[model samples]
Target: MSAEATPLSIHLADDAATALFGEDLLLALQIGDCVALYGDLGAGKSTLSRALIRALAGDPDLEVPSPTFTLVQSYDLKIPIAHFDLYRLSDESELDELGLEEALAEGICLIEWPSKAGRALPKNRIEIHLAFAPDGGRTLTIQAPEGRLSRLRRVIEIRRFLDGHGHKEAHRQHLTGDASNRAYEHVYPVDGSARLVLMDAPKRPNGPPIRDGKPYSQLVHLAEDVRPFVAIGQALRERGFAAPNVLAQDLDAGLLLLEDLGEDGVLDSEGRPIAERYRASAACLAAIHDKPFDREIVLPGGHRHRIPDFDRAAMKFEGELLLDWHLPWKRDGQLATVEERTRYLAIWDKLIDEISDADTSIVMRDFHSPNIIWREDRDGYDRVGLIDFQDAMIGPAAYDLVSLVQDARVTIERPLMDQLMADYLSLRAMGPDFDESRFLKSWAIMSAQRACKLNGLWVRLKDRDGKPGYMRHLPRTLWHLTVAFEHPVLAPLRNWCIEAGIELPESPA
Candidate 1:
């Protein structure tokens, strides 16, 4: 806001004219920085003016067409830079009438053709003059009091667009798919509410690739899904579910701070074993199942990727991955013929169709041991907290049941799995429909789908993202697969894994 600030110079000799304007605008400014333009028509004033506005708006290709008729076109820059083209001003007094002064007071302003409003302008405004040359080239002169154009000048000298600071730097240092990449974890000071856990999404570097890799990519790095996750978290809290309260989200920065669960998870506080506590831990899952949300909430991309219908192909691929990577690798290269693979796939397809046709319910896809945290408030054993459910979906209720009963981390005792299922059905008041025989059959089919997909995912994770530690969980996942496949309900699939030579672990819970 001071005219004493310094002004930086940039050369526009070659095709670097537009690039110079972009670089200058992005680097030299923040929200609420103001700029003024001075030039003749076709003097390249509009060209440089457009570039500057686009940079602040987070739109490098933003088309800031002259507001010939509108006179003023306000822009909501990533910060807040506004652009005004006053070529159509009927008179110099028209400037004040248009409230141009107010926009300047509120944010950084860019005014084109300042001469049209000469005496009506501010006292300490920066001025840029563009005049035509004999050869049709334009000479631009930027003049301001010593401090007037300081920020804009500084931006022009920046070596990078974002200039790489704060959250941007954190992302570059942290974001990665590498297993060795330590999970970006933080413990926050307790605020009167339940303890909170905050996970900083690994910060990605500045540029185009942030949006390119796993799910989707874009020039922007904001976590597009954070909004829905926030909505669901709020909804769950309203329902009295044990989901952590999402405290705050800097979606543009992919940062979320959540309420922390205590050190005690389903596994253990120190991650050691406590055999006697197993039954109660398993019962906590039943408590969650008692409260199912039936409302369909709008998510990012609207509902294109809604559950059940959305995850069907992904679900089928989960089974296919078992056949594609894990099974073939486990067999040590004993290959199957094209016809044999086709026939085996039909079995998985049939099972998936049957499960999909079942009554749909909210399915917490990763509702297993690692996700549940223990809390002391709801009594030691029943205080299980759920996390890692950014991918919740609508599906057969049995899917998440299998996630817990046939956990990937360890096996559940047959008696315990049966007891948990019985308890869950009873709590929900479904005595007749929750028949043991029918429940177990649904559980087996869903479990097989989850297990195969999980194993396949690990393989893909290792091969694609360089995260090899997930491969260790593959053996247990195969054990679950074998158990589910062996049931008469999944007998056809069990025979496929057997003939394919994928070894199933014999470990018992």
Candidate 2:
């Protein structure tokens, strides 16, 4: 083991505590992880393994038979697990025949009596030594590779946070996370009552300065901590929107127990956009834009969250994503020339200048299908429950509308998108000083801006972040840009794209 392999000790008072520890381990575990359990005959290795397997299966009643006789037993769950009891193995080389390598390649592995394997185990396996305590309980000494120690420590912190609150016995189930660093979990009470959401967002550390001594996140005004969510959600709720209520919070720790806004999003059962829900969402945005909003929002404990402006710097920075990531990716590792970058940025500068006096509101930076919840029980604008607005900024009202009508994740047909746009425009036109022509121009500029940002963002997420799935949206974003360039304001960008060999489809699909 490396010199940095430090052991963490934990005492489990009873079976329930041991089970909870298993759940914590599940949270920390990833695919290809090997957990080696070391204990004597009557220690809690089997108990811990069973608890972890059951938790991964999301079934408390799952039958996890011991693999002692079989040597290896596999379970096909969310993250496939292979439970191995190598005590019966006669030779270490038999591990290959038992598919130990395959198990570790495809999913997680739990090994009991791992000593039988000799040096066949992976070097970075997590080791858990369990022993009987003097008080008839169990004690565990756990050590993991240095690269994985941070995740294990985070799991321990989450458990402590839950215990400090009134949810020591809550059953935790992992929820799908977004592209950001934040993660979430469903916390169910011991009594099987309503569930809550645990937002586990750690404060983001500053990266190497990209420009003017600021990182990309700071330039684009991304939320660094959970305070923005707390403040923005409170502001939205006070304005009659259905943002999730904060049940409990730890600002310093970036943890929040939020009311579980149910999983009915704007998409239907088949993952297609529901027209009525889309219209409702547009109306909700209109209602939000029409209201007067304060720049500084008072959070709990009298602290304030000052909403940042979507300034020219932010807009230019985002537009450059296309130049930085997408263009190079399209050209097979060849970067854009200095002159091409200068021209692309110049076009963006003009577009941003054109939208200088456009309608301003508290723009939810990601007001799209994924962030929108369809609350059927609620009426009017309240029917649309908002989440994931921590990165909200004060910017062009048309930007949110663009996010909805031209959703990044889903393809919204031109007809339905037009109707949704009309739904929002008609409502906003009733307000004082609403200029249809100017708003449409701003809408076109913002649409093209968003398209440029997303085109580069998808490539960055794929190449730099190891997330290739986001690349699937590249075609749709290109289509959106093509549509945006139909407006006269984006003609310069359209010509530049054509000159740069970026294809723009002539017709919508």
Candidate 3:
């Protein structure tokens, strides 16, 4: 194994601080990792393990009893976790009977009294040595063998980064995430001051070239790092929209300390979309659509990122995920033939070309309910706070409008969708040269394209990423597919679905 940087040592003032440390470290774990907890009796090892397990389970009140007698306790989480206490084991060979190797292979294992297993402890693991602090507290000194440095080092880097930003003593709580590589933490300063949201989206490694020696992200103008977010949020703030203000940044590491937009969103307590909030959000979109989108946004370090246009190739490739992953999964492991794939692309090709004919503007690719924070304290469309715009691109203005009305996460009733459409057009018509008919045509085409893309995206998330919960959204997506069929432009794609025995919910049912 290659050498890594120095060991990261952390001092926790109390059990609360230990719990918080556990929460931060838990995010960095993966399957097959064995976190060996080494400490004397009552050094807060069990306390730390409980906090980590509860954080991973997303339930603070979860009961996690000591496993000294039970030996092992496993929980089925997004990443399965096995909590093991080896204090009662007589010999290292007992691990074979306890199935330690098999457990480690299947999921993350938290091993207590690892010395009981002695040399049997996994070589590739993180070892945390805890002890009593001089001042009535606990201390933790973390040591990761070089083979395990990649996991723990990132965790240490986050703490160092936060320390440099005047938030060294901030308490971090995990925020629920969506289908993105980014992880968010609600950073609350110990002084009860204003909170900040920490976005940790590291620069992704480039994949094999898919087109013109570019990966899919580059081909489609998807933001590969947080630089686009800083640049785009600045442009929006300058234009009077409410995007989170960047407080501190480490762009090289893809980390940002942003102003917390608060927990209140466009959705109500029952998770239903509020019409007034939706209207405000739609107005926000109309306001930005007329801005200068083709211009380059200045980023840090004298970097300029020109927003790429949503070209034909990018649009078609998105729909290909349907043919590539969704179709084959639906076919019970049978892959689509070359002829079927060709026909699918031909249908989408027409839609892509026709939609690209319309006027282009910045399309906040995901302007749906989940990304919009409703700040009632603010006035007008400023009340609508926009988040998650890293995937923004110069696409048809109608694309974001469609994203808002035909939201994938929440259902917007037919009447409310119609009202939002009218509100947007009326707002835009007051501005320069607005074509209602052309905009409507573009909306239909883009909405249809988005629906087709989502139909497969949900399945791909389930099969490729091991997120089967997305399958629950598949039915709503199919209903959306049928609604798009109302637009005659999508008839060819609809007819193909019929031939493929793909079920579509009866329109307006």
lDDT of each: 0.59, 0.91, 0.84
lDDT of 1 at 96: 72
What TM-score would every model get versus the actual structure?
Answer: 0.56, 0.97, 0.86
Candidate scoring better on TM-score of 1 and 3: 3
lDDT of 1 by residue, 1-509 (tens): 24544444444453245445543454444334445676666667667767666645546577777877888887764456666777777798887767776777677777787677767777677766666655545556666766546545533322221223111111111111223211333332323333334444433434333223433212211224455455556555666666777655554444566666655665655654344345554555455555666455563445433332325555665567666666556667555678768987788778877665464466667677777766756874337676766556666777888887777765566676667666666654552344455555777888888888788778867767766878877767777776776678787877777776677767542
- When superposed on Cα atoms, how far off is each prediction in RMSD? 18.5, 1.3, 4.0
Q: Residue-pair clashes per candidate, as listed?
A: 22, 0, 0
- Rank all candidate structures by their TM-score, best first, as comma-separated numbers: 2, 3, 1
Weakest 10 consecutive residues of candidate 3 by summed lDDT: 1-10
Ranking by lDDT: 2, 3, 1
CA lDDT for candidate 3: 0.84
Candidate 2 lands at a TM-score of 0.97
Model 1 TM-score is 0.56
